[model samples]
Target: MKMTPPVTGTLELAHLLTRRGWLRTTEFNTPDCTVWDYAPSLPDQLAPEQKGAPTAIFLDNTGESEFYFVEPATRTTQWNPYSRNFDRLEDLIQWLPVIENWRAPRSHEHESPMGFARLRAQGLITTSEMMETLEHFPYVPVDPDAKVPSLSRTVAEIHQAHNDKLLSKNEFKLLTHNTFST
Candidate 1:
């Protein structure tokens, strides 16, 4: 369950899971979001009830993501309640096995990225359902090759100094040329 710090980006998260022995089974993309389905490499790794079930990670363009367990037969989905708003990567790593074994209640039929695509293709989903689906797995317009912006080393030092109270507000403003502010 040990892992490095939690990544805020999709690609990093995917790499983390793959390194932990989860096999990427399928990847689906749309203008709004990208969904990757993963399953344990060994069947024995799954919970008895979750054997053969797949888990999904939905990554949105804004670097937000959600995890869900999908039931293969009914296509029912369950969101991992423990997976959100975590402050540490270890928290998520500890929950990975639990999430993989989690199952949605048969009585509740929640929307999943995979289920949405399938139902949408068959024309079985309504506009409202589609909207609801998107709410859970929103559009992720990520460009894999796009370079993320980073502050210059000098700027970073100034920012750090400001944070550490080594620089007064006026001093920070003067040192950064008013280009950035916390």
Candidate 2:
């Protein structure tokens, strides 16, 4: 048997996709922007509907406020560029427990803590195991006090280099692909 290659990207993207109904049959499209459309189902596991029914969203994360959605009943996609928005994929995922209706939505629900307690009570997990996991795999930390980099400055630099005939678009894409690939 052959093993599948792992997809490489920020864990933030994976967490977002996993949380947002994408554990089952999901459709991904890259239009002017990348969009991940996933089916609707229970949160316990990412299983597809046997009835072949699905609901979807076209997430346009290429900067602007463009986004879309599709439902099983209508069989039509609805585009809403400015209706809903997310600052980052992580924020999008934090809304999942509510969306899946596994637990009631409360403004002050401490999910991680509660989950740990439940698991411990069920004899499925221990505090030491949780501590070890955290110690071994820490959060990706960016300098909290550091100022954010300006995207325009980076873009302008690229444009100037291009106008000076430094590199072609194909070269740039190749460079990007290599940079992200392991």
Candidate 2 has an lDDT of 0.34
Off-target runs (Cα >4 Å) in candidate 2 are 1-11, 19-28, 41-53, 64-83, 102-182
State, as a TM-score between 0 and 1, how close model 1 is to the true structure.
Answer: 0.31
What TM-score, to 2 decimals, does candidate 2 have? 0.28
Alpha-carbon RMSD to native, per candidate: 19.3, 19.9
lDDT by residue for model 2 (1-182), tens = 43323223334555667675564233464533344434432122322422222233345534344333322111213321112343444444553332232221111122232333344446665645432221221111133221221223322433344454443465334433432222
Tell me which residue pairs clash in candidate 1: 32-139, 32-140, 33-140, 60-140, 61-140
RMSD of 2: 19.9
- Write the residue-wise lDDT of candidate 1 on 1-182 in tens digits: 33333335546767877776555544464434445554431223334455243455544343344433222222233543223333344444554553444333222344433444345446677534433332222111132121221354323544665576544577556544523222
Candidate 1: clashing residue pairs, number: 5
lDDT of each: 0.41, 0.34
Q: Estimate each model's TM-score.
A: 0.31, 0.28
Residue pairs clashing in model 2 are none
